[model samples]
Target: MQPWTDRTTPRPALAALLTDVVPANRRTLILGPHAPQLIESVLAHSSDVTILVRSVSDAQQLGEDFGPCLQVIAGALDGLQTPPYDVIIASDGLDRLLGYDSADLSWTARLDAVAALATPDAVVVLGLENEFSLLNLLDSRPPHERHGDDEWRPLHDDPTRPVSVDQFRTALPWQAEVYADFASRTYVRADVASAARPGELPTRLATAAVDQTDVPLLSPAHEGLDTAARAGLLASVPTGWLAIIGAQPTHDIYTESAHTVLTATQTPTGWHLTTTPATTSDTSDTASDTTGAAGELLVFDPGVVPSTISSGVSVESVLFRLAAAEDVPGFRKLAADLGDWVTDSRVVLRWDDVVYDGESFSHGVSGWVAQETVAKEDLLAAAWARFHGRLIGQHRRHPWPPWMVGDDLVSAWLGMSGVEAPEPTPATSPDTLPVASEQVAKGKQIAQTLDDLLGITNELADLRTVLAEAEAAKHELFEMKGHVYGLERTLGFRNKAMKTRENRIRELRGQLQKMTAAHDRIRDSRTYAVSRVIFHAAQVRKPKVVARKLVRKFRKR
Candidate 1:
């Protein structure tokens, strides 16, 4: 039989949880029959791993394919009689076991069964589809179908049956680390935590490391937002949820690409969350001293007050100051707060980096600090303009407000920079005013000329449309003419065949006439008359005379 799951790659969320939360050496128990990639990932890390499938055939097939390294059990969760495992992964199959008919009892029994299979401190990873994703609101089809998985069969037909984040927590009755799966339910992109909390800031950046193949699950309209912002939005209305139960709290989270590292380190003074640069090294050039040099770090200040660290300050001092904060929880929260502040303040920072040409260069950092208060309307106008510009870049025909061009756009830009639009000055002298009026009249004449030109262009476009239609009709007529010509050729061939047949009939009639003449000649011959006269004389003779003639004839024979 074919594989039960269509997935070739392990779900991103599941992979993240496995790499970050579950220990490599732990004896793992995979409760559900998952994708092959997921099974391989679990088996690679854990020596004592068992997969619980629904049927004995599935177990036997998996065992034959994976060999004896993996133990496959064929039974229900409650029926399985095995030792408690250190980690239990239930990425799929749990939802089906927990039937949609009775959600409460199903969840309760499912959780109990799961708890029984796991050790007291085992890490339980549960994945569930979130019905309230933004894409669901925009589209009528199921999320799986929209993602190109048309054959995916859901346990419940009703969209409302799927558990929400709140419902999931209530059912589990545990403090679980919740993560939002973007692009699809299988890929976890960001952790869902209070945006107000500083500890969750790394998750925002961690989203940047998500595989680029996973794209705008919500819609193309959201493509304008950066990865971090998009991740936050996904966390708000996630496509799916990955709940890591009985897992330890994490202080730092690195993006999958490992380009950015967000660390929450505790100093002697206070707890500080810092986002720093993570560098990759090339060891091919051993002679070069700067071969493994790290990239420059840009630490955003989370405090309300602008950073005092100047460009003249030493890089070490700046790093030290960034490492010492009063009450930040995580890198993600700090980043989010800073982002929000930047949006509100309309303070933009532009940076340029200079790479060293030789091994003599050392790692250095530069800093910029600014604070500004902009009006709400001005900020809104500025944001709208920027967003509109981005939309124009993304789409071929972006919808723009009719009145928001020329002077309006300029005014918005000025207002966004916290500057008022200058008013027009009045003309003071009467002589200058008359000249200005004459200039206005000329401008009106020019506008009229432009209007006439526009009308002529429209008429030309219409004529082009008509000419294109006429050309199409002419081509069609030529095709029809070709078809008629072919038909005439076929008729000619048929006429030739009929003529040949008529000649054949005439030749046969001539042969028949010759045969009739030969038959008449054979009937009129003198030998046929002599044979008829002899037969008539024998029939008229008496029986006695005929008997005597027959005796004489017999004697002669």
Candidate 2:
């Protein structure tokens, strides 16, 4: 029973046992580092399966692969409700790796809590490796020669020097014991296999069929198979089989063409199909049909991707890029397949630091290609740098930039810009300061200036009226002065008339003395009296009326 080589073979056995013995319509809770694979297999057998992951990120990945069909819970088992699953299987990821004694119930209590969540009579399954048993299978290396036993150590710490299963087990003592104890019943046993050679079985377990082969989960340099052979094996895995491949030494595994091919295509059920002959140009409908509509989910280790972390670059980064490259046609097919599944689907892609999406003008890809290839750039890095610079500049300008923009105001600002602003709340709001009010104030000032101008115009109009009145008064004064001069001339004429009357009186006196005529003297007296009366009337008369009357009187005189 070379379990590692025949990873898919156990599924049929497990499926048969489940469908034949266990009742249908049962809900299963799968807990493991690689629980997705088991869940995928179980889903094929049963639809009512709920997967619980330890981390939020894991849940997201599961959702992406399963298309929201799977319900994921993030809390640990200790906090979960009872009877949550009909059958529960905790895969390679258990607290066992954390160095607790195998006999302790702490790890078991966690499992019990998980099992309690299952339906009554539900069987609890745990996937684990026997460390002590496996250590016996190493290439007879001394105990001191083995690497450290820290569970967090990189999978590829000794890539060039592949450690045998027994050596690895010896290095990690508590890990194997924990695995052995957690299972209600064990199906895949690592005891004999870990102690045996790659192709051989242990004499003690050889007679019994419960055996396994020593195959490196990752690339092993000393292993007979090279990278290409391993890749071929990975690609050729049977349908309904999902593989979670991680890189050694924290290197990326999705980069190489082999990894790319694996990530690009998905297995539907079995690996029996012979390799098709390469065509100069694949024009067939099936060949061109790139839809990965039906296949197992392939999850690549994102930690190996340098773009995801701030750590140094590793070979694993290459793996992700390669997978992305090979997935062009496959992913497009998947998108089409999912068309009927979702009312709306959005894919946001960021390469260096530049972000793009399916909604963008270019449909996520910024640069163009040869109509077949996708150009990959280190855009995520660039975008991150630019974003940091902008943030720093903003911080320098504002001590509390976030606080400056209240939650509601930020939303309003975003709304003004025609973007979907979040609701105005503490959690959803941004903390930028308000400046639009200042603009409004400036506008008010402009209006006030206009009003002042209007008032000035009214004052100018009033001054114009006053100037006209002053000019009229000046003209009336000039007319009054001319009247005074006319009156002075009339006075002079009256004085001359009086002098003439005196002379006439003198002449009358002379005539009276010379002629001694009573009749002439009486006539002169009458004339003098009449002339005096006429002069007095002329002096009392109005200007025009008096002048006209004086002319008539003079004519009579």
Candidate 3:
């Protein structure tokens, strides 16, 4: 109502329903303001398309986008005055239109309003959420709250007012074909009659989750529910249910998907059961002329009765009932009445030597029967061997660490077997053993030999330890020897330097002696005496001249 802007891409289930049920030339009326993309897709096939919206704003937006080409009604479904439509698609909007909190409006009244707008022969498709879905079981919150719809208001103050499958079915004017939708209700799988049949429900519901790209919508705790469903559990509980109103039931049983089809048709002899792959041309063929070569068919006797197996019935009980029927006519009659008991009753049995000629088989039996035929002794022996083999295989695959061998391994093996393990025995010393008189001499000899061997072993270990220490000491000595060689080279360099200094000193001393000798020789020579006298005379003459000149000058003055 607040200008619905969340345009979810049209789910595949809705798309498939639209394509399968809606005609290209028929006038289609969409009861809710759906995604724009969905509207565009509808326009490609049908020329006359009208969408009903709750708000004027939504109508205005749609009108602006499509102009006059598409008609947008700006009112609720109850107030709309529109011509009868050939196809009407309401994607779970009826509940909202009726108002969840509106106590005055009944579902019947709301359905009547929708019926008024649809032609008598119109194909009406309605999508509704199952109140008893797996998602609801895990969470008590309403869908609007879970989906984070801030504007959502409960129809009533009570939280348990959601529309259920039974309520939805009762509101419908005609019988409808219901399907379970998965992947947030995007993909739909047929809710076949096998689901209604006892043992067959598991097979019918055992289909894989609808192919989806989104992460599964199931809680982690409920994750295994799908596998259980495939194994023939949860046939009654589906995520959601999609009801196709105005469609006639053609097949005796519906399959989860179009690909797997089961059909039962009446013939002159009896009812013929046939399983076939759905052909693109004809999807609703319950009976085909082909033999077992193309598809297998089982002919049932006309007097056979059909009975529903309770979900609580066990396989053993059913087998017991089957065996009892071998002699009792009444039991046989009852078993005959049980339609598809083997498949629908959820009884799992392994079969041996099973063959199919597209009709019946030869020497086919359940695995339980084969197991029963094996002798108890042989079975026990085989089981024991298998257990050991499994243990050996585990050991080979992931052997225990060295520390876990012997005691730890034995303890683990005992624990796995649910046995209380005893304490491990402590090793005994040789001295603790008692010696008898007769064997004392022999025992002493043996003891002496063992002691000697042990002493030798201890000595060998000590020798090895000494050898390791010696190796380390030898390495240190080698390092010391290298250090000593380096010191020697340094000392030799210093001695060479000292010798050169001594040689230089000797040369200097020799030179000094020669110079002194030369000096003495020159001083004692006649030439040296003459030269010295000349030098002294020059010196005395210069000063006497100066004195004479000074005396002559002073006298003149």
Query: Where is model 3 poorest over a 10-residue stretch in terms of lDDT?
Result: 344-353
lDDT of 2 at 213: 25
TM-score of each: 0.42, 0.26, 0.40
Using TM-score, give the best candidate's number: 1
* C-alpha RMSD values across all candidates: 29.6, 33.0, 30.3
- What are the clash counts of all predictions, listed in order? 9, 34, 13
Candidate 2 local Cα displacement, residue 426, angstroms: 94
Query: 278 in model 1: Cα distance from truth in Å?
Result: 15
Model 3's TM-score against the true structure: 0.40
Q: Tens digit of lDDT per residue, candidate 2, span 256-333?
A: 110111011112320111112211122122222321211111112222222221111111122223333654444334
**What's the candidate order when arranged by decreasing lDDT?**
1, 3, 2
How would you encode candidate 1's per-residue C-alpha lDDT over 386-472 as one tens digit per residue?
Answer: 333333323323222546543354344334344444555566875543322332232233222322221212222223335666797
Query: What is the TM-score (0 to 1) of candidate 2?
Result: 0.26
